[model samples]
Target: MDCIHLTGIRSYGYTGYLPEEQILGQWFEVDVKLWLDLSSSGETDAIEDTVDYRSIISLVQDSVKTSKFALVERLTASIADSILALSDRVTQVQVILSKPAAPIPDFSGKISIDIIKKR
Candidate 1:
């Protein structure tokens, strides 16, 4: 299988357990890996034969922005489901969601979740 990776996609959205987080929103980063067959695309050299990444990005952005989730695990699973629904070519996916500025008392960098799904 061929894989397409979209890493470090940044977006601002409301996703957290705190009230302030839901009201003020926060920045989130995501990385996605999509697995599919690329033989037709490689042979024909046509974009139509491959998964359209722009659409995938749009789907991710829309999903994160419009929905609110308290846990990154839920968000990650939602993203994986959305991607899987978008194309049958995507046989499996790996999703990562990161919160760089989480309101943790002792954390300085970020917290994130990594999830894998096979359809």
Candidate 2:
């Protein structure tokens, strides 16, 4: 299978266990790898032949920016499910979500979750 990779999608969202986190939304980064067969799209060179990534971006944006969750695990699952709903051509999906500004004391790097789902 072929894949489409989207990385470094940044959005502001209120999703955390802490009260301050919910009150003051933080920046989140999302990465996705969508697996599908691109042979037809490669041959035809038509938009209709392949997944529309702009639409996928819209879905991710809405999911991240418009919803609140206590865990990025749930958020990641939601993103994978939503992407799967886009087309049957997608056989599998992987989502990586990160909170770079996580409120952990003395943390130097991003805190993140990664999940993979198959249809």
Candidate 3:
């Protein structure tokens, strides 16, 4: 299998258990890996023969930015499911979501969740 990696996808979303987090919103970063066979695309060099990354980008943005969820797990699942639904070529997907400004009092690093889904 081949992988198409998209990293540092940032969006503003309302997702958290805390009321303030929902009200104020936060910046979420996403990294996605789409696994598929790329032989046809490599041979043909045709857009239709491969995954359209722009469409994937749009789908991710819409999935993350348009709705509110209480858990990053849900957000990640939504992304994975949407990607799987959008393309039959995708045999597997990995989504990583990070919240840089997580509500933890002392932590400086981001809080993130990673999920892998297979078709």
Residue 107's lDDT within candidate 1 is 79
Cand. 2 Cα-lDDT: 0.90
In lDDT terms, which candidate is top?
3
The number of clashing residue pairs in model 1 is 0
List TM-scores for all candidates, in order.
0.96, 0.96, 0.97
Which scores higher on lDDT, 1 or 3? Answer: 3
Against the correct fold, how does model 3 do in TM-score? 0.97
Question: Which candidate achieves the best TM-score against the true structure?
Answer: 3
Candidate-wise lDDT, in order? 0.91, 0.90, 0.92
Cα deviation of 22, candidate 3, in Å? 1.3
List the RMSD of every prediction in angstroms.
Answer: 0.9, 0.8, 0.7
Any residue pairs clashing in model 2, and if so which? none
Ranked by lDDT, top first? 3, 1, 2
lDDT of 1: 0.91
lDDT tens readout by residue for model 2, 1-119: 89999999888888888888888989999999999999999999998988998888888888989878888788889999999988788899999999998998898799889999999
Ranking, TM-score, top scorer first: 3, 2, 1
After superposing candidate 2 on the true structure, give the runs of residues whose Cα lies further than 4 Å from its correct spot. none
